[model samples]
Structure formats: C-alpha cells, structure tokens
Target chain A: MDTSVRSKGTLKLMIVDDSNIIRRRIERSQQIARLEVVGAASNGRAAVEMFRRTQPDVVTMDLTMPEMDGIECVEELIAINSEVLILVVSALADKATAVEAIEKGANGFLCKPFTDRQLNDALEELLSEA
Target chain B: MFKEAEIRTFIEGTTNYFETSAQQSATVGSPYLVTDGNPGAYEYTGVIGVTGARKGVVYFTAPRGMLTVLLMRMQETDTSDENIKDLVGEVANTISGNARRDFGKNFVISVPVVIAHDLEKVTTPHSRSFVIPINWRTHSAKLVVCLE
Candidate 1:
C-alpha cells in the first residue's frame, strides 16, 4: 500500500554501465520504487564525472565497461568518496569477483539476472545499513 | 562427475536465470551428448574460462534471436547490436556463475569471453567436460562443460 519509502528526500541515485538496456531496466524498476535518478553515465569515466557533479546517495554500477572497468571504477570512486554506497551490478561469474567488489570499498553486489525483488533486496540491504 | 544435489542446484539456478532473464522456462530433457553434435546456431560463442580443480570452458551458443532474448534478460531491456555483444558476454558469465555454485566454493570461475562465430570451437587440453541439456520451454540446447 505504501511503497513510497516515506523518506522526505528522494533516494538520489546514479547508474553507470555500457548497456542502455540495463540502464533502462534499472530506471524503470527504480521508477516503481520511486528513487530519484540524479543521472546516468555510459562508462566508468563518465560515472566518476557525474559522481563529482551529483554526489548521489547510491550508485548502481556495472563491473565491466568501456573507458574503464567496474572494479577500476570502484577504486577511483572510493578514493573520491569512500562513504558513497556503490552496489556492483555485474555479470562476473565468480564469488571472488563479488568479494573483489566488496573489498574495493563497494557496499554490496547485485548479481545479473536478478529479479526486481532481488534488486530491491540488495538496495534495501545497503540502505538498511545506512 | 557431479553429485545429484550439485546437479540439481545447477539445473534450478540456471533455470531460474532463464525464467527471469530469458523470460522463458527451461524444458527438462535428455542429456545432450556434446560429442555427438554441435553446440547451437549462434553467430558467437559465449564462453567463461574455468580453472583450479577443473580447467575448461562453460560455453553457450545460439541464434541471434534466442541469444538476443537471453541478452535482453541479462541487460534487463531490449537493446541494439552494440548492447547485444555486452549482453551475451554478461549472460554467459551469469550462467557460469549460477553453475559455479554447484562446484561448491572450492573451484574458480573466470571472466566471461565472447567469440563471434557459428562453428563449434572445442576447448582443448584433454580435460573431461560435462554436458548439460538445457531445454527452453519448447526448444533445447546443450551446455558443454568439463572438469579438469
């Protein structure tokens, strides 16, 4: 009945990935959750650029991308803002990869082929920590 | 050489990916003997390198339409050709990751690799591979695997 998170300020978020499809998916899904999309970036470099500009509350990032990879992106983003919630949205096929993201200051991971419930769960998991 | 529980998990997890990602259910069927025929009718081969106890490949091959559908699921939307390549690589990775859970936490999984082609490309080194017959609702395909 009350899906609107009830937070006075919206969940300002950013999505960085090489695929427009994935961006659109996160966009549409978060639209239902009503998260405010600060903006989107096509690659890691753009992600860093937008991060500096928007300083979003959360970032849904992909591990593999052009101009830079997700791991590298996390490394850079971490240096700038260690407090930001960076949830990896990736197709990395190994637990180590997931572990790697977390080790690199990422807040959590969002495995590919995830359901909307999963997306929400990971989001809530990170948000709950906040 | 997979235990019943392990194989069951592989089947269920991979099937879940197909259902939510591919928007189709995998139809259970006979074991597709990889040595008997080809992988599928794809213009590219979706592969993830395997190492540690088992060293080989988890490969996926299918037509663009079928592959496109699977890719769309992975990326979570209908995309153009530029995105399709990325989606294929990611889907292959996701499937292998799902299957990796069956190997328990002892084995290793590498990054997904995409080789554009329609021919059967063998993963050599004389390693033993497992062939999982994946049925997609009405259609079926072979998931070629090996354990070093």
Candidate 2:
C-alpha cells in the first residue's frame, strides 16, 4: 500500500466497535491519518443504520457484537451498496472467521490492538482500492 | 491440561493489549498454579469461556482505580460503574482474541461476561488455573487461564 499519497480530501469513514475505548482509539487514529470519522457504532445493527445515514466511504467493523455480528453486517452493507468498502477491524483474528468475512464481502481485515500506522495503512489501502 | 505455550500466548496477549490499546505498559509477574482458592479480589472482572480444542475459561480482574485510569486515557470522560465493567470485558475479549492467532480456529472464545464485585469466590473447579500477576502504572491485575 502506498502510504505517501496524502489525499487531504476528507475520506468519510465509520468506526464500529463494541468497546468505547476501541472506538475512541480508532477515531483518534483516523484523525492522524486524515480520515474523517463521520459515524461510530457499537454493534452491527447500528453500523448498518449509520452507514446508510452517513454513506461513509469506508467502514472499520468489529465482529462478535451483541446484536448482529460483523460478518452479517458486511453482507448487509454489501447488499445495500455493492461498492461500499468495509474493513473488518476485529479482535477475533482467527483465519476461519476472516475468510468467512471476506466471503461475506468485507474488503479487508485488521486485527485488534493495532497501531496507528497499521490502522492508517489499512484505511489507505482500502481507499486506494476504492 | 493447558500447555506452556498456551499460557505464554495468553500472557503475551494481556501485555500487548495494555500496551497497545491503553498505552499502559504491563509487566507480568511469575505465574502460579491455582488448584484451589480464588485468584485474588478486584472491583471488576471479565470472564470468557473457551470451546473447541480448549474447553475452559479465561478471565481478567482489576480494581476500579486501574480501570478508571484506563478509561480516562481512552478519552472517556464517563468513568461510571457500567462503563468500567464494559472496559474490563473488552480488555479480556481483546486479550483472548489475540491469543486466537496462536491457538487457531480450534480455540473458540466466547464474548466476555463482565462482573462487578465479589470476585473472590470465582473458581474453575474442573481445571487448575494459572494465575498471572500483571502490574500496570502502580495498579495490579490478574489474568487467569483454566483449560482442560
């Protein structure tokens, strides 16, 4: 992924995580990466709702949520807009679930406890692809 | 029975979660086997059940002060009891999830169940737990792993 391209035009992004701390961390990291966090949700249900309302360019989703899991949300979002870019940012890093999510239509995956650089790179890679 | 490598993975996960997520460096003390008795007491605890190849439980316990500091650093102004409980569960979930990389798909971890208070009686009778002492910024916590 090319990290040098500093496209200042704010890329609307949505962060989905059950933990308030994780969401805050992602929001803070996105600010550093020059990505605009237009929406934040604690679960997949909220994620889909917010995605429709915000129409974000990219989404960072977390699996194992209470209401709806990230894989289902990925499918829902893809159904809503086939071109939507969804990145699974989850603590559950198992390859089985990762492959399942990809099959469900997630654009990429980033495991939890990620650094700012990793988050930025994933977002940038997703954005570049889009 | 739990393997040494599995214990090491859980320890590494705990340390990494604190350092990376909360920006707090966690130093793990010597791990002792807990055949009986509780793994100390704390204001909050996060317990998760593991299925598949490993069938048992994993938990993280910490005081309110430590969790409050963590929440503050995480940019949360509301350090209420509910949020603190939620933070503890999230921490445990992240740690267990990190360990999944080493344990693979067979080590299926469930969502965390947060408990606020009376953690002294909590015990896994079926398996001996390895209680790992973790200290972060003058506050202390424990990561308990019991598997069969």
Candidate 3:
C-alpha cells in the first residue's frame, strides 16, 4: 500500500461516471479540505487514460457506462496503482453487483441518490481505511 | 403484462429518487397503462434500453422548466441544454438501476439516451407502457415503464 498519501499533502482524486450531472455532483460536493479532484472521465476507456496521466490517490467510479464499465476500469486502475482507494458510486442496487465490484477491487460502495453528507462520509471512510 | 406489485417496485424507486437526491418528497399519482401510439412526454426525455432478463425501454420525461428547477435543487448552477439532458438521463438511470434490486443482476440496463421533444424513436411496438405520474412541487413528470 502506498502510505505516502499523507506525506504528499493533499490527496489527488478522480471522478469517473457516464453522467455529466453525476460527475459534476461528486466534484461540487467535495467538502474534504485535503482532497482535491485531479481529473474526471466520462467512460471507462477515458478513465483508464486519465488514471495513467493523473495518478489520482482516490477515485469515485460508476459501474454502468458506455465504452467501458466501472468494473473493468477498477481492475485496470488497481493494476496501475494498487494503493489507490476506489469507491464504487453506482445506482445498481444489487448485492451481486456490489459483491462483484468489491471482488474486482473496489474499496467501498455508495448507492446513487446519495446526499452530500453521505458522499462525504463514504469518502472519509474510504480514506480512513487506507 | 406486469403484476401490481411489479409495477409498485418502480413506483417506490421513483419516489425514493426524489426524496434521497433532491431532498424533497414527490407525490406519485395512480399508475395507468397506455397502449396507444406513444404516451405523454414533456420537453425532455431520457430513455434507457433494457435487456437480459427483460427487454424494453424505461424512460423519464419531464418539462424543461421542471428539469431546470431540479438542477437547481441539486445545486447545479449550469442549466444549459446539455446539463438538463444529463439531469433527466440520470433520473431515468437511477430509477431503472434501482429496480435491479427486485429484478436481480440479470436485468441489464444500458446507458441513458437523451431525447429532446422526440418520442417516436422510443415507442415499443406490441407493448403497453405503464405511465407513473410524478408530481414534484408545481411541475409534473412521467416515468414510462415498457418492459416485457
């Protein structure tokens, strides 16, 4: 695990979702003073490319997307940087899908239609675990 | 034909969306079936294709004014045409995705396909659509469920 996140000052974050509103909601709901959004991607293919370039310490991922889904993107992201914390932010409200995402490599799961407080709490939990 | 309980699943999902995301409750009127050409649609519509366990389209249609207000409720300042479309699509996606809890993982859903004042392309032949009326504040929207 990359423990240098605290030493690097602010933690770099990435937002990956197909919906522009969702991406923007996550971006605008950033209440963590130490967390800074580094990049945002619409699809998994674009997310993979952005992950390579930005190397975000954390990522908020959505499962159902156009080109590449969140599951594949999570695997690729972990392969690139195993220490990167990922929280699956999806509307798919099924235990099987959530378990599948966790099995693949997501650190946590947050259902859609979440409040701002819920989002901040989830992100805080993900970072605390790391 | 879907059972009353099956349809209720979607109704709960719709009401839940407003309460959770928008931080306000939306009243759901009685659901009715529309087997004609196309059901009523507002200025903007977001369509999602369903496959796997079931096959059809699920859409959320709302007026431009309602969507603009919804965007504001979500704290989204950008109410451009593109953002409005995105907001409507997210609503449709969230409703359909929430149904996966009852439909299981086999109920596959596609990414949202936003439509602007066009309903002909979304009509499903030989299928009756269940229109669930959603009343939020002074605005009215519809969640059309067309599934096999």
The number of the candidate with the highest DockQ is 3
Q: For model 3, how does the per-residue alpha-carbon lDDT over A42-107 read when each residue is reduced to its tens digit? A: 999999999999989999999999899999999999999888889999999989999999998999
Best candidate (score: lDDT):
3
DockQ-derived CAPRI band for the predicted complex in model 3: high
Clashing pairs in 2: none
User: Where does candidate 2 chain A have its weakest 10-residue lDDT segment?
Assistant: A1-10
Clashing pairs in 1: A63-A70, B27-B135, B42-B62, B43-B117, B129-B145, B129-B146, B130-B145
Cα lDDT tens digits, model 3, B18-105, are 9988899999999998888477688899989999988888999999999998899999999999999999999999999999999999
DockQ for model 2 equals 0.54
lDDT (10s digit) by residue, model 1, range A1-130? 4433234357789999776667877877763253688899988999999999998878998875667888899999889977778889875546877887999999888878777777888887887776
- Top candidate by TM-score: 3
Candidate 3 ranges beyond 4 A from true positions: A1-8
Q: Cα lDDT of all candidates, in order?
A: 0.68, 0.82, 0.91
In candidate 1, what are the lDDT values of residues B18-95, reduced to their tens digit?
887766687645543344334343565667677776566677655566666665555545556666665666666667
All candidates: TM-score: 0.73, 0.88, 0.96
Location of the lowest summed lDDT over 10 successive residues in candidate 1 chain B: B32-41
Task: Give native contacts recovered, as a fraction, per prediction.
Answer: 0.43, 0.63, 0.81
- Give, for candidate 3 chain B, the lowest lDDT window spanning 10 residues: B118-127
